[model samples]
Target: MPSQITRQITRHVLTIPAQGGKPARKVHYRRCGQGPALLMVHQSPRSSSEYTELMRDWAAHFTCIAPDTPGFGQSDPLPGEPEINDFADAILEFADALGIAPCAAYGFHSGGIILVTAIKRRPQAFRCLAVGGYAIWTPEEMRIFGESYLPEFVPQPYGEHLAWIWSRILEQSWVFPWFDTREEARMSIAHADVEHVARTVSEMLDAGEHYRAGYGAVLRAPRDIPAPDAVVPPCLISAYDGDPLQAHIDRLGAMPASWSAQKVATPKEHQDLSLAFLKEHADTAPCGALPEDGHEGWLELEGGLIHWKGAKGGRLRLHRPAEELADPSKGEIAIDVPGHGQSDDFDDMKRAVEASAEALGVSDIDWPAPPAGDADRLYPDMAPDRFGLYLQRAWQVARAEAFFAPWYEANAAHAVPLTPEAIATPAVHARALARIRAGAAARRWHDTLAQIQGETA
Candidate 1:
């Protein structure tokens, strides 16, 4: 059995310039392992985190690079609702920007479509391609997806969207067109677990409104299979029996000489075959290091990915905040605490804080005193109705004010004000509102957990 030990993954950001003088946009990705390069494109509404297990498994044989495709995950969306070709082009640009070449690629679902299109347009960029599932939607299905499936997901002030999102992800496995309530289309894989629903909902939150662009593009993409006589790179197209795209193997009537399609019995089998195929063709050249985006970004600490926003070389390196949690000076660096802002949380706060400070190149011994007062005083203004939801949103806003505000000021177009109603503060500074919201949500989350534990006890 695999050891199941978590992989040491590092997050990186690369800003790539647009063609024809359009401004450059930031692309975020997670990289792990070594040896031959394998670009992993994730499914819609999820980030590179989806490939954690896969990356760890493949680390022994290859260097796995998974990027959050534009408009989904942490990557910026295209200028507008983009065509599938635009996404394909973005992948090529991403590769060029990173100076990675002679690569093999693997994509799952929508990710697979993007890679397939990328290879179709620029076959030489990759040595081989392996995809989990490739959908060939008919015009009618595309119309339905456009009309109902890919609706713009906006934050509802009352938190009603959360409930809907939870249900949507949970029932997606049970129904073909997730929105369709017809009993005939029900799937055997439908799950009703709350935790599973919550996990996907968190990812949906990360993608926000941009989910439409990525998912929509895939749904609307041209599903052109190469003619038998046409030339293309070596490719393996496989789908598990229950996957909707399994039937697409039939649609791929006259595949290129190098192409092969199969219906696998299980997901493990699909991945095993994919890894074997990619390994067979991998050249294993050492791709150049990822380019650095100057100032304001993430640092992977022992606890989790720490989101820091500031320039290095501050006069006085602030190890942590004092009781008041005051704003950083012109030369100060501020970080969102683990599980606080963009940083992920660890069960042990003290250890996480210590590790985070060290990762940020600050001395752990100089740790500042924590904020004073209890949880209620910290977030006095939060609505009692849905405190947890409000906190999560607020935490993101708080970080934006402290670290991102300066960056945004320099780049005015990137500074989007939090929705007044959603942030629950038309009068407060965006940063203050965020702090209040995070505090409230943290309290609620902890309180709920305690209650559940006590009941079970």
Candidate 2:
């Protein structure tokens, strides 16, 4: 059941111009409400989705805009090894692209580091800032984090990376600096709830090995706080009691007159404090219209927004049942069918596609060829399980699909022409991510495909 708040918020993808020799990239974001612009940045390894409820509440008084920071969610990675400065610059890039004229910003953990750097680089560009936690790590502590934290996350043949990532995130709540299992590192608040752990694990999957760059940048970043007399916008930095960073409030020595730090008793109080601070300082200027490429953008359907790319009247490329939009080079126009990719799930996917086409004025439809004889077997149950097998299952299908027309059939009769690219680690990993992201929605899409083709699902 979708909440009313979820409906009020809308998601979009903006194409940022090429930078530092890198090609143009897509940045996904969530927007809602109608007041002073508030740019919300989430912690590392998590996307804007984590702040859905927070945005909902803040939306009542402010235009909450939270973006999937570069290399985290649907946003593309930076050109190369990005330092704290690169991520900071990326934020300004997003702001300029979206035309949020001097907005108030908020950030948590790694997000806080980036925002701090951004404000220091261009103080006049922001109104104020509300930071959840500000870390002032000592050199010895940074060395320890550098040596033990953020292991290289290379994908494994049997989805071993998936198991490791799930445990890594699950244990993060149990202990600070997850790799430190010692009693001293144990967090005051800890739980192993699968639902919560699953969300972080999925985000880790999206970031892949780039987690090291983002996470490391934060740990290695020096405390960039300015002197009390330095010119800067007003900022409030607060942390909840159980949070590891709550203790770091003491380390923020001699802050500027306009800045203050506090330790709240609970997360609710922490958020309430941040919200109140932002409200006090938030500018009354209007957040400009959301940027959109006239050619490739979201189409608002009755049920939900449909994500489409390329030319509208061009040959419409539909991906496989559980697949997302094909590579842009494959065709002029492609769409992630409802219930797959970034598009929202729908009760009637076939009709949803028709409605999307009608709305886009897309007449030249080019549907995908139905898969060979694979039923629900091709689309397994990918719900979060205690053992984290769903991740491996997606990997299994991804690997098998390369050699056989229907991944379930391994015999020579069903063997397809072998291609090196299909079996490559990166290719298989990409396919597995697509299947994992689709989740049980893949089954619904497969059933819809069967209905369209008049065959068994």
Candidate 3:
């Protein structure tokens, strides 16, 4: 294991009046490194805290600045739910307020959506952009997500909600694997751990009703950034298999020549790859090389040792403070998936799985058998080829028993009042069943069985 990097940095909180009656604002930002400026925009339901570690590393090369977007973390909410354009303008204003001209910007997920919009609106403000997992949902996909926006899976008694939320995210890969390659997809799934998944789910739900509202705003917004063809700066859009944005890669693939696209397995790898590309291609350059630190953590599935400080959260220890990550060692890098450590919301589950797998060197491998006792009895007659599957199923059963059972029992008292027309409705139940069947069919159980047989042989 390599030693982690230790660096000192400063954080500043500025209250910039919103442009044109939007509202007053208090923005907390961290400044580090020396040289060209780099602004990192975090995704929705999260704060500037997401990039603490990455910023320390990147600051070594450029002055890295990360801010909490409006309506997230400590930043004041936008006046009445601003659109993507509002976010773009807010970022532009943030730049001007900080006196950072012609700075390079990077955004992940919804943050990417906002930055791309900003670049299109004011091309001169940014010199380059690196976007991760940009979501461009198809019409039908949007419809499904809109309907399922407030999933009833919020865990009861709070504690179980953690595991419940984690399972919901883990089950998502069965629906979509957005990477450009199988290796990327496999590596991405291998890095998640139960604790990380639980924490992220808990945070998103804790954000109160605003969580659903924020999601609704994005879902109601237009599909593409209003100006897809505006060529202001060199842009790189990257995605991995488990990334929800992976489905939208085709949309980005159609971007004008100024933009480029690639897929990597993990978030840390994506950041490193993007930084290396920027160092080579982007005119704005980093200042100097920084030394490594002594942080160490296990990547759950991938079985690799990741070195960094603030291991519990997303903070990275660096030799010097900078605005963004400097060059890192080649190969996959681990990041805390959302809701765990410093990341916010349930979306971090995908990244966590990938990071854990990478740390543990367990990519594409089956999980060990369930421990002795009740766990063993629960699945005595069933077998799963992948460790994730077993864990996912166990979580689902535990959650259903823990949360839904009491609700169902209590509701029975009102069962007589429940009209025949009101009980979940046959059509809804049918659709749900159909979705389940389709999911099972699409999972290609036979393929997994074949792989298991091959391994045994």
Candidate 3: residue 372 lDDT (0-100): 20
Pick by lDDT: 1 or 3, better one: 1
> Which digits, one per residue and each the tens of the lDDT, describe model 1 over residues 43-138?
887778789889988877777899889877668888876889989999989988887765889999999999989988888898889999888887
- Model 1 misplaced stretches (Cα beyond 4 Å): 1-6, 315-329, 347-355, 358-457
Which candidate has the top score in TM-score?
2
Candidate 1 whole-model C-alpha lDDT, 0 to 1:
0.69
Residue 62 lDDT, candidate 2, scale 0-100: 82
lDDT of 3: 0.52
lDDT of 3 by residue, 1-457 (tens): 1112223344455677645656677665655666677888887566676676777777556677787776665455566756667777888988888778577888888778788888878888888888888787778867766676445433242234444444554444443332223443343354445544433433353343455544456556665643446666888889876676766777754566677888888778888877875565444654233222223332213222222223333322221100111333333233323222222223233344445544444343222221222322222121222232433443343333323322223354323343344233332322222222223221222233334456666
Task: Give lDDT: candidate 3, residue 191.
Answer: 40
Q: What is the C-alpha RMSD of each candidate to the true structure, in Å?
A: 8.7, 2.6, 16.3
Off-target runs (Cα >4 Å) in candidate 3 are 1-6, 150-192, 198-206, 225-229, 265-268, 280-457
Question: What's the lDDT for residue 112 in model 1?
Answer: 91
Residue 131 displacement (Å), model 2:
0.5
Residue by residue across 1-457, what tens digits does model 2's lDDT show? 2346533778888889887686798788988776778999999989998998888888777878999988888888876787898888889989988888588999998889999999988888889999999998888888888888888899987778888998888898998888888999999889878888888888888888888888777777779797899799999999998889998999999978999999999999999999899889989876667876666667777788778887666667788877889655534677888877778888888888888878777786666656667565777798888778888888988999889978888999999998899988888998998887788777777776667677523
Question: Cα miss at 411, model 1 (Å)?
Answer: 41
Q: CA shift at 24, candidate 3, in angstroms?
A: 0.6
TM-score of each: 0.79, 0.94, 0.54
